[model samples]
Target: MLPLSLLNTAKGHPILVELKTGAHCHPKSPTLCEYIDQRSTVDRVTYNGHLHSCDNWMNINLHEVICTSAGGDKFWRLAEVYIRGSTIKYLRLPDQIIDIVREDREFRERRETLSGNGTGRGGRGGGSGGRGGYNNNRGGRGGGGAPRGRGGFSKQQN
Candidate 1:
């Protein structure tokens, strides 16, 4: 699966967002874009912070950010920054994010088991109940009270 597709996994975790333009204004970072149009020489302005939220456009909201210049010499801290999706070059996610994702999956499975939806098919174990053992759509009724026949729906001659 696509890693960035699960943005919620990185929420409250540190992220590094580098802009394509790198206008030198800072306070900018990661976006959810497929491409970027930049003809100028790439000057990286990295925004390092904990992601608060991200939209489908790749626009990210971060807190307690420190903006670093391309030379790695300049540094400035900010309380919060909203990085536009269009300007984003790429995003750097945490290494431990996989562990967090696994934990989240396990938690959901446990909840499903508790709710009796362990089948993961909306609690529907099987299809149309013919005579019934489990999942009888009849709601515990005895198969519409139909009698056993000789051949078809009628009795045969002896």
Candidate 2:
């Protein structure tokens, strides 16, 4: 099963989408997309593209796609393509994506440290506190040991 959150994070990012190729991953049987595997014996086909969007079913829309045939021999390009999630064997995301997500999380944590108002999660906004971010009683704004998520998203006034 694919992690939809991670897939969403991949939006506007480059991805290598390997379609189900002749049961290679399955071992018992090969299921291939007729459009890409018309030859019937092609071992693999991959699409290098920028992810545009995805639906609840994990179906994806890609733009600026480049299709590569088995063993990296032949290549063709498409302006855009839509891929059904079921036909996808796996998706390869860039190494930096993990770092990007980590940075975003860290930035929020730092903001929480700065918000200083012990109101609630995103204290100023009454937002859904992120990940166990509820503390009923804290002294007030500018206090130490500020709970994480309490001040998240609120602008700090220095």
Worst 10 residues of 1 by lDDT: 143-152
Give per-model TM-scores. 0.56, 0.57
Tens-place lDDT digits, model 2, residues 2-107: 3676678889999999888652222221232444445756555688999999988888988998877777866767777788888888889887877777777788
CA lDDT, every model vs. true structure: 0.62, 0.64
lDDT at 96 for candidate 1?
Answer: 82
Query: lDDT tens digits, residues 68-134, model 1?
Result: 7666875777888888888988888887887778778889888866754224432222222233233
